[model samples]
Target: MSEAAVPDGRAAPTLTARQPKAVHSALTVLEAVARLGAGASAQDISRELGLPRATTYRLLNLLVQDEYLVRTPDLAGFALGAKVVQLATVAAPPARLASAARGVVAETRAALRGGVHVVFFAGGRLTVVDADPDFPLSDAVRLVREPERFAIGRLLLIDRGAADAAAVRDFAEFGATRQLGELAPAYGCVAVPILDGAGGFAGARGFSGSRPRADDPSDVLTVLRPAAARLGPLVV
Candidate 1:
């Protein structure tokens, strides 16, 4: 809050002071839910913030109505909603690549028959480090907005342990994952994870093209594996 000093040495709120107690409490409720992850019940939030149970419920209802949060499938809890993604994380600016990283991306693109892209996972966010100039991403907006729909995004989810069982199995069996005709009809993408020296996930390198190419990603993996190793140090 902003305050103005009166002639009598008393403090008065400015006419343009920002949000009041209700607004602050509402935002606090949002932060609590986000920290609790999915399936955070009203009771959980009330206890976490030490707010009155009624107040927590009221704020939750308001947030859900405004689409800033959504009830889970069973309607027992809530998760951050699409509106938050659109406002906070959508279309993050592309990250710059070092000269050596650029060289690796160029060489990989030349060897592969499809689009080659690089993405980095940091701060629980995905950033496009590089996108193939010739093929450009098919749907750049959705790539960031809906990561679950793309292979590269799945890599981040898998590393975070938030991916579905199918993604987990695919990465275990093939050391890679692919999305076939999901992002666009007859088009698909395959992504391989990059591991740092300690073998933790660093990021991912992706190849996108026809569905057939994605179905048989062995060739794509061959080209991407060495490139990922080279990029591990440069990008991380």
Candidate 2:
């Protein structure tokens, strides 16, 4: 309000809020799309973000052109694109592989809508490095008692023997599924291994959502494979 403080004799403009409207809008749009996950249409994003139809299409188009999002095969929906996954490559390095995977785990949960966990062997004890607070393993007690039933426990035993390794190798390479009793009688998981730069087993990453009978194995693998691959280099 002080004229003396004004650069050109006009009273200084008052700041009403933090961050520019465009920048804020873009971020909200991005977040909405991320939560909506793959196969979400522009209409879904527009509704979720309370954005105008025109603005939604504009943002979607821009994101697609920039590769932050990709049009589904039918060209009727959107999914996370390469540019989005590349962010994991630059995730800040942490003291251990688990710590480094924290951020990527959050992204995985949002994309898969399930309990996303990252575990690594540290100091001879297998530890959970990062997990989505929103999606805890359906039955933690049962999971501990029965490791062979779920993907997490099975993947962890991957080093048991050459025969066991061979049996699970294909599963880990392409993502493996877990039955109810192996994890939880109500839910299951699809997991893949995380390898270090030396090609050693670094950790495992996966999602536990609906039961296998409820969700397609291929769909779960589609999300987990890329996520595990993306976190591989960063953790290694």
RMSDs, each prediction?
11.8, 12.4
Best by lDDT: 1
Best by TM-score: 1
In the predicted model 1, the residue pairs found to clash are none
- Residue-wise C-alpha lDDT for candidate 1, range 1-236, written one tens digit per residue: 67899999999987444457788998898788767765689999999999999989999999989967777644888766646645655556546789998999899999996789888787667876676755656544357757888899999999888988777877897798889887457778989887877888878999988898888888788898888889899977
Q: List the candidates' TM-scores in order.
A: 0.60, 0.49
Worst 10 residues of 2 by lDDT: 136-145
Residue 121 C-alpha lDDT in model 1: 81
lDDT to native, each model: 0.79, 0.62
Enumerate residue pairs that collide in model 2.
149-182, 150-182
Model 1 Cα displacement at 225 (Å)? 1.2
Q: List clash counts for every candidate, in order.
A: 0, 2
Residue 47 in model 1: lDDT = 98
lDDT tens digits, residue span 77-173, model 2: 7766545544532343333455556667667778777678776633322345564445544433223334455566566666443225533754655
For model 2 the local lDDT of residue 112 reads: 78
